[model samples]
Target: MTAALHGLLTGLTLIIAIGSQNVFVLRQGLRREHVLAVVLVCLASDVVLISAGASGLGALLRAAPQVVAAARWAGVAFLLGYAVLAARRALRGDGGGMEADARGTRTGRGAAVLTALALTWLNPHVYLDTVLLLGSVAASHGEQARLFALGAIGGSALWFTALGFGARRLGTFLRRPRAWRILDGAVAVTMLLVAGMLAAG
Candidate 1:
């Protein structure tokens, strides 16, 4: 129980930090587009990553700096591209809620899922957090590492569920074009910052 609780707290501490994945999930939720799918991908991803970490894949990752570097560069490129799109959206400002229009179109399910995957898999920080930091912590639990991982996975499940579904309550506020502009602006800035940080690191 102690291990599980520790894992839960640690996972929450890492996962609750605002990042590209969370931002995408929140946006999809607000748009009411493939929320279930996106949330599931995120959860499933956490399951695999957390499990891999607990099972000692973290050690392999540490030995492979090249792998980390590849992911880092990929993430920088992806984030930069996404940030540009978001910036354009902010500039266009012809927004309606979750529809395909001249300014922007609602993405299809496949696109959403692919995005969820890219945002989840491409970010090197995800690896450092889940596979490195969390794994090292779980390893300290010795035989109870699995339980610790379970607790961490539980934290991920709870957070993504709330972040995705709970965003609907803000629909009223987000319906305005200006609200979307503000959101896109914020998203653009956040993406740029993340990319910059990843590059600098």
Candidate 2:
């Protein structure tokens, strides 16, 4: 029970951050575009990562200082690039007026799923949080490690479901291009800040 509670708390702490992926998922949810697929992708990715962390991969990762260093730098670069793209969109101040490309619209499910996977895998912080932090914590529990992992997985599932479905209401407010621009701006700033922190650490 204690392990489960700890896992739940850890999952919540890691997943609650405002990142590019979260923003993207929320926007997609609001647009009602491939919502189910997106949610599944997010949840599945979380499960995989959290499971790996609980299974001792986190310790392996922490053991490799070089890999962690590389990942940190790579993550910083990715975040900066993403922030630039988001900032560009914000500056353009265009939103709902812009329709998705034919390819994106037609392959929305595949795109969203792939994007979610990539976002989960590519972010170095995910490793730090899931593999290092969560894994290390769970490991201390000895036999309860598995239970803690299950609890973390449950937390992830619950969060994604709530965020994806709750974002549907955002459609009402984000219908206007102006609202979308504001959201983009906010996302851009948040990403930049996260990137900065990651790099500094």
Error of 1 at 173 (Å): 0.8
- Model 2: which residue pairs collide? none
- Largest lDDT belongs to which candidate? 1
Give lDDT per model, in order: 0.91, 0.76
- Residue 1, candidate 1: C-alpha displacement in angstroms: 1.3
**TM-score per candidate, chains pooled:** 0.95, 0.85
On residues 1-201, what C-alpha lDDT tens digit does candidate 2 reach at each position?
A: 989988887787788763766876776776667878888888888888888888899878867877778877777787787788778878886544235443243335776687666666667778888778888888888999988988888888888888888987666677676876887788789879878987888
lDDT of predicted model 1: 0.91
Candidate 2 residue spans exceeding 4 A from truth: 97-107
Candidate 1 lDDT, tens digit per residue, 28-119?
88988899999999999999999999999999999998898999999999999999999998999744455544445778899999999999
lDDT of 1 at 55: 95
Error of 1 at 61 (Å): 0.7
- For model 2, state the Cα shift of residue 195 in Å: 2.2
Number of the top TM-score candidate = 1
